[model samples]
Every structure is written in structure tokens, then in C-alpha cells.
Target: MNPDFPILTLLLFLPLVGGVSVVLLWRSPATARVFALLTALAELALGAWLGSAAPAAGPTGYFLYQDLPWIERFGIRYTLGMDGISLVLVLLTAFITVIAMLLSWQEIKERVPLYFALLLATETGILGVFLSLDLFLFYLFWEAMLIPMFFLIGIWGNGRKLYSAVKFFLYTFIGSLLMLVAIIALYLMHGAQTGSYSFALAELVHTQIPYTTGLWLFAAFLLALGVKFPLVPLHSWLPDAYCDAPSAGTVVLAGILAKTAAYALIRFTYPLLPDAARAFTPVIYVCAVVGIVYGAWIAFAQKDMKRLVAYSSVSHMGFIALGIAAWSPVALSGAVLQMVNHGITTGALFVLVGMLSERTGDRESLNYGGLWGKVPVLAFFFLFFNMASAGLPGLNNFVGEFLVLVGTFRVAPGAALGAFLGIVLTLVYTVRLVQDILFGTPSQPMSVSDLSLRESATLASLAVIGVYLGVHPAPVLDLIKVPIALLTKA
Candidate 1:
């Protein structure tokens, strides 16, 4: 990696450029798929190279920092930086985008080129969110990602696509408006105090805010970020959006998009309003614990496999929230690792479920039976990811969840216990899901094919990563150690 090169800029634009090329250059759907896949592959390679070669830290604890003037009048800049925290998320975004493209290859048919283009555009927005160090830049990316996804769901999704897309838009859009207001307020306050109006995160953190004002501002930011995190009560939009969106759309929604909110909580909220964060710790704990149990309890009753998985995400994300609220070094590390873990495992689950739907033309769990005897390979991968989702010992989710629980127990035992019960519920549903969909006699005669090479390859890659991380997460932990320590200390 050359120090002089704008690697982050390249990473950010590659997908956008690829998307434009897909629209203007590719004539057919087939060529468009190839072009999009190749572009995503290139992005992933670049991310991998950067991850391996980039220095551990740079000035101000950011690697490959880029700061240049964007909107000088308002003190906003085109600032981009990647620390360990953002690095892992960047890689996840790249990896999942590729997976999404791969999953879309055969599934998406009408307006294929447009679909791929929107998907890539969404990628750019997500990558921008992770990399942007300027608050204004971050919010710009935040809203930018929403439009493409809205179209992705509206144009291509299943049952109630338009309704789901609108619901998703309204929830996030309202929250974002609140956040934008808070950002401007913070900028003005900072300017009033220091005569230096800026939306730079580093600068904003030093703003002097009165206690009540800090609490109010933190509440606004929390509502905005929490809507995306879909924290408990605000999560009603998710089940519809997740269940109605196309498989690839669902993967991006559950896998990478939701993680952005959690990431923002770490990057912007806690550091910018430490006093408010401490004050609201108890509230966060309640929401996290409730979300965990409530999500799983609902999931246990879902007849639709996709809906079940969607609700399960609420449960899993709650664990991440729990880890964040714990505010310990170990808990924070677990939350970060869990963000990646949930992406891989849940994304894989959606992929597998989509495959099942493709084969049987149905997503109802009761419609499937004795699939293990019929398609052993698909059954294996399905069970593998399910176990991973259930947080079985020696698997990836277990590592993250264990760390979160252990860390949370040190500070909040009652909340930890509530989360543990949620895990038990998770296990129960996991078994029921596997049994209903993979075992027993079919209710009717239905011919279903097994996994193809492409599908198998897609799942195999995710499975390998899950196993590797489960057995040894030292490399990732090491990468994020310094960043997490700094966050904890602050």
C-alpha cells in the first residue's frame, strides 16, 4: 500500500463506478452480472490487501487518514479514515457485497442491470458510512444508502414490497432527520464555544455541552441510530423489510446495514457524549435485554422461515447492543467481533433459506420435510449455519456471545441473565426450525433439487470463515484491540 495513494477513496468509488458502468456499458443481464461480480471481487481484493498491508495505526489512531476541505464555510471536510474498528467493517461490507452479487446472479431476473447497479450503489453508501470521519460526510453517506435500498426492495421484493419499502424508508428517514438536526445543533454549539464550527468527529468530541443539553442531544442521536439498529420497540419495520426484500437485499439489510448503527454508536455517540452515554447505560441495558427475549419469543412462533430469521436478527443484534451497553473492553471487543459474526452467520442463513425457497417454491417451514435425506449437502450447510446462529460452543457466535455475556455479567447480572434466557430460547427455536424444515415426512409430494455448484461455493466460503473465526479469533481481536482499548479508556 502506498502512503501517498488515496486507497480509501478508491475503495469508496470502485462500486459506484462499477454500478455506473453496469448501467451504461453492459447490454445484457448476463454481462452485467459478470461485470458487477468482477468489480465486487476487485473491491474485496483491495480491502484484503489493505487489511493485510496497512500499518496498525497512523496519526490520530486512524490508518490511511485523508482530510481535505469539502464544505469550508461550515467547517466540514471530506475526511476519511479507517481504524481497526472500521477496517473490519469495511472488509465485511466488501465481502457481503460480493456475496450479495453472487446470490443475485440467478435470482434477480427483470431489470437485472438496474438491480446490480442499485446494489453496487448501496455498497458505496455503506462503505462511505464506515470510512467517513467527518460528521456531515457520515450523515451524507447515511442517507445516501437508504435510497438505493428503498428502490431495491420496492422494485424487486416479494409480498408487500412497496409497503415494506415505504415502511423502511419512513422509519429510517424520520430518525435521520432527527440526527441531522442534532448534528447541526452540535456544530453550532461547538462554534459558539470555540469559534471553530466543525463537523469533524475529533473536534466535535471536545465540544462543551451542558448536562441537560448533552442528554437531549444524545437522545436524538440514539433515536436516529437506534432506529437503524432497530432497537426493540423501534424494530417493527425490520420483520417486514427483511421478509419482503429479495434474498440479496435481505442479506445486506441484516448483515451489513444494521451493523452501521452499532458502529455509529461506538464511533459517534459514546465518544461524543460520554456523560450522556454513562447516564443512559441503564436504559440501553433494558432495551437490549428486552429486545433479546422479545425477538426470540416472537421468532419461535413464526411460520415463515424468512420472517423467523428476520426476528432472530433482532435477537442477535440485541446481544451486540448488550455488549455495547456493558461498556467494558471485553464486551466492546465481543460486540465488534459479533458484528462480523452475525453478518456471516445470518447472511449465510438467508442464503440457505433462499436456496430452499428456490428449490421448493415455498418458504414455509412446514412445507419442507426430510430434506436431510433428500439433499445432504444443503442440509449440512443449513445445520452448520443454524448451529452457528444458535451460538453452539466452539463456533463463531458462541465466542462473541460468550464474551458479551461474561463482560455484561460483571456489570449487570440481571440483564446478563435475561440475555442468557434469550439464548436458551434461541436454541429451542433453532432445533425446532431444523426439525421442521430438515426432518420428518413431507405433507405433500414435491420435487426439489439439491444445491448447485455456485450455491455450494457461496455457502462454503462463509462456512469456512465462520469455522476459522470460531476456532481462533486472535487475528481479528488483535486488529481491533488498540481501537477498543482507546474507546474503553475514553
Candidate 2:
């Protein structure tokens, strides 16, 4: 860890700084997008550099760490660091932010400046969440992201935007409040035991927690994450939010926001309260399996393209949960890598869906067919991403899901079998989606332009990433192995 250099701090706050500059260009949306893209690209470059500089996997908790005192009285410090897990997520966030900026370039007409600014703000918050090692700091970043996201959905979204925004906000906010309570309780508990106050995660992890207390804290944390993960019954807000939010907003919501829950369970919940995590593992595993099957079944039945993808996210995230429940190095590593895979594959899917909607002026899958005849390039990319999402071999999703199933089978064969069935169910919906949109007889005769150069470039970038990860996922798997090992240690 290099305390001498504040690179992490720059990476964390650079988007916010850029966002303020973008707001100054309120009158010029084109210029705003150019500046925003440059800012996002710069952040991506910085993340790449940081990942390159990261130390090899080892017994140490993290390297490339930064720590500073922010509040003296309460023993809260501005601490940040990254191991293999954090680096991959950081890079994923940076990469996705760039795609999101590109996605909103022409789609967002009203409040253009505000829209780009919110995207940048969301990046800052997500980066802070991934990098912050201080509990207080993490929570601040966690909740700080809501404002921008709320406005993004409410102002720039589709029908029932405001309702979806409020639902999204309330669901997450309620969970965050419970999380706050848990953080404070843990803080006080650590202070009482150590004769000093601190919100440092390193310090808190060492705090001895009673079984009853740990269970309650775990429940609080799990509830908070479950809402964010939108697992099963708590998922009603998710499809509404995804369907109503703009495509760019959907990218962030489905890509990183939900992944945070899986990351949190591995990073904080498991290590901080090992016993509680183990105790509740079976229950959570059941929820994950149910989500897998339920989300797939529901998605298979959806007629709307956007809503179908939204429900598919619920199904994909269920796999992440199943991987976590397995709790083996292979399973955990797969979960971490799957988070990145989901972001890329689904982000591309949403982008393509957005393009289709933009061209046709509708999101209903039933309204269109034989798109391949009109827009071959778009059809090709759509098929490519669909293959990636459906976990075809040699693609990124396959590697993660395969490892997850293999790991789970070793520990819980029944759960693994259920997940496999979910995968099969996913094939049913995803294939049907492709056929309905691209292969069937024309539902409505129409001429549509193919993907523009800019759109092609954007999808091409994501497609390249998907292929590289699919063929050579070793880099990501290698990067995350140490962190998974550290977290799953007895």
C-alpha cells in the first residue's frame, strides 16, 4: 500500500470533480457529453494503472492502501484500499461508467447537464463504496449515491418514472437505515471492548461478537443487501425501477448496484460475523435457489424487452448468491468474477435494447419481429450478447456459472441441481427473446436504421471485453483469488 501517493483518493473523487465541470456546460449538451466521456475515460485509465500496480495475491488483507484521519473526535478516518477483489470491481465500475456515459449521449434530452452530472456522481459514490475501508465512509458513499440515481430515474425515465424512482429510493433507503443501525451498534461494541473509538473495518473485524448479537447484526446487514440484491420477494421494486429508468440508469442499477450486495456479503458480513453467516447460510441459499427459478420463470413469461432483461438480472444475481452460499474458494472466486461478467453482458444487453427502443419507439417484444432483415449488425451484436448472457461455453458467464455450480455441488448437491435447472430455464426465455425479436415473421412492417457508428463502437468495446473474459478469464480469477481466500478463511 502506498500512503505516499493519493492515487486512490483521486480515482474516488475525480468523477465528482468532473461532474461539477460538466454542470457548467448546461447550455451545451454535446460538449457536456464529450467532457463527461473524457472524464470517464480518464478514470478508466487511472483504474487500469492502479490494477497494474497492485501487488500479487498474498496473505495480506490488501495492498495499494491509503489511510488518513478525517474525524478525530469519533475516531473516524478516511481509509481506502484494494486487494484483488476491489481492483476488479473498481475497474469494472470505471469501464461501465464510460459505457453508461456513451449510452446517455443522445437519449437524454431533458436536463442533459444534470443527467451527466448524476452519472458522474454515481460513479464517485460507487468507487467510494468499493475502495473505502472505513465503515462510516463506506456508508456515506453507499447512501450518497441515492440522490443522483433518484433524480436520474424520476426525471429521465419512462412511464411511471416517479413512482419507480420513489419505490427504488424507499426500498434501498429503508435497508440503508437498518444498515446504519448495524454499523453504529458494531461501532459502539468495538469501542467498549477496545477503550477507543474507531470505524476502521480492520479494527471492527477484530471485535468479538456474541452469537446472538452477531446473528442480529448479520440479519440487519443481510436485509440491507437483500433489498439491494432484490432477491425473490423483495424484488418487486426492481423490475419497475429497471423498466422505468433510462437505459444508462438501468446499466448502473443492474450492473454495479446489485453486485455491491454480493461484495458486501463476502467482504463484511462473512468475516465480521462468521458464525451468523454460517448459521444463516442454509436459509439464504434457499432464497437464492428460489430467486433463481422464480426470476427465470417470470422472465420467460415477459413480453416486454426491457422488463424481460430486468427480470433476467434478478435471475443472474441469484447465481451470485448461490456462489456465496457455497463458500468454497472456487465458488467465491466465481461469484466475484460473475459480478464483473454480469455487468458487461447485461450492460451490453441493455444498451442494445435501448437502441432497439430508440429505433422503433417501443419496448414491447411483441411489437417487432424479423429485425435481422433490417438491422443485421444490431441483430448480430444482440445475438452475441444474448449468447454471453445465456452462459454459452467460451463466454464469460459460462466460466462463472460453471465454477459456481461445481463448487456448490461439492458442498450442497441439491442446491447446485436447483441452480442448474434455473440455468436451463434461462435458456428458454433468452432464446425465445432472440427468436421473437429477430427470427419470427414480421409483427409490424417497418424500416429501421441500423446501429450508428457511435453505437457500434460502444457495443464493440463491450463485446471485445466479453470475448476476452470468456476466452481468458484467468486474469480476473487470479486477481480475485486472494481476497476470496482471505474472506473464506475459518
Q: What is the C-alpha RMSD of each candidate to the true structure, in Å?
A: 0.8, 1.3
Query: lDDT by residue for model 1 over 1-490, one digit each (tens)?
Result: 6778888899999999999999999979999999999999999999999988898695466777988998898898999999999999999999999999889888998999999999999999999999999999999999999999999999999999999999999999999999999899999999999999999999999998999999999999999999999898999999999989999999999999999999999999999999999999999999999999999999999989999999999999999999999999999999999999999999999999888887777988887889899889999999999999999988899999999999999999999999999999999999999998789677787777888899999999999999999999998998888889888998
TM-score of each: 0.99, 0.98
Best by TM-score: 1
| lDDT, candidates in the order shown | 0.94, 0.89
Clashes of each: 0, 0
In candidate 1, the residue pairs with backbone N, CA or C atoms under 3 Å apart (3 or more residues apart, or in different chains) clash, namely none
Candidate 2 lDDT (Cα, 0 to 1): 0.89
Residue-level error in angstroms, candidate 1, position 139: 0.2
TM-score of candidate 2 to 2 decimals: 0.98
